[model samples]
Target: MSRDTRAVVEELLRRIAEGDHERTAELFAEQLDWRLDWPADGHPAVPWIRPRSSRADVADHFRSLSAHHVPELNGTSVARILVDGADAVVLGEIVQTVRANGAAYTSPFALHLTVEEGLIIRYHIYEDSLTVARALSA
Candidate 1:
């Protein structure tokens, strides 16, 4: 039996975590639907990253250090990946070092994804907004 959409999506996320943009982008449907909770701040504000949204939004969110080029994502560990039919939940932890203030913080995140017809239809994210602010201020 072929892997289900959740499996495919998990694999896709793995590729993105390793910085495989091209392959990551290929997994999405023609017009992907993306939603983000973090403010772009001084970086590229792509509110809705569609048709392969998660890949770009993630990359931009990491790279956009603004005033201080913070430590490039010290470490990230995916805690869980659960698929309930077409919907999936991904929980992970991210640690980063702030360049300007020389501070570090670890934040937990949760991503809810819905895939249909082998394509990502919806992406919802939940993270600590204050942690992001502190890191940026650093």
Candidate 2:
């Protein structure tokens, strides 16, 4: 028996909210089609905005994100979640204070996830990369 798309996505979100990066990765497939809306050249200051493929990389991404931000000041407000069959889209806004420069940035984000066999195989995140990049800079 396989879980529904909403259930899978909700679990993933819960794990992330709890700051359990390693456990969150368990909700993903061994190999994932992951992408973040950032340039190929990548921002030298933003460490988490990079290509990720395997489940391990997924955990790494979240961990790196947390490492660069002030955890107490980091927050996400999810406006809605839309689900159809195997696809789920999460609309939210993220707020974070950079640990490096004490800079804050807010970015509206759309996360598209495709769940199959209770595991997320497709993960694509669209967010305000420019805002995030600027926040990371001095």
Candidate 3:
């Protein structure tokens, strides 16, 4: 990855850590496209934030998460970023605590993200799938 791509990835991680939602989305171009492979055994079909080529998609995505009131996740830590030109990878951990259905639980996870052109184009996420499933079911 070029240094520029690495810089972009670093900036993205910083923005996310700050929970700057608008700024996080702004980094992606209007013609951007993103893909994510999240563990699906437990969580609902709520969309995780991603870059899309359409502004409408961006609005819809953010609205969906907000409407669901997916509590702001905690313990998000981007460990490192590796850039390979237009493609880059980020290794990190994410922790979320959800209180719904009169129950509560937490999900801790590790992940690898692949980005392109300053936009996340793909994600190969791996984590404790069962733990996440149980938390979401709570």
Best by lDDT: 2
Candidate 3 segments exceeding 4 Å error: 37-73, 101-130
TM-score of each: 0.69, 0.95, 0.62
lDDT of 2 by residue, 10-49 (tens): 8999999889999999999999999983897578988888
lDDT of 3 by residue, 64-86 (tens): 54443345645456666666667
For 1-138, candidate 1 gives per-residue lDDT tens digits of: 124866777777777566655566566665556655455432222222222355455444334432233436467678888888888888998676756567777889888877777767677777775676665555
Instruction: Give all candidate RMSDs, comma-separated.
Output: 4.8, 1.6, 4.4
> In order, what lDDT does every prediction score?
0.62, 0.90, 0.54
Deviation in Å, model 1, residue 17 alpha carbon: 2.1
lDDT of 2 at 107: 91
- Candidates 1 and 3 compared: the better one by lDDT is 1
Enumerate residue pairs that collide in model 1.
32-51, 101-138
- Which candidate number maximizes TM-score? 2
Question: Which residue pairs of candidate 2 clash?
Answer: none
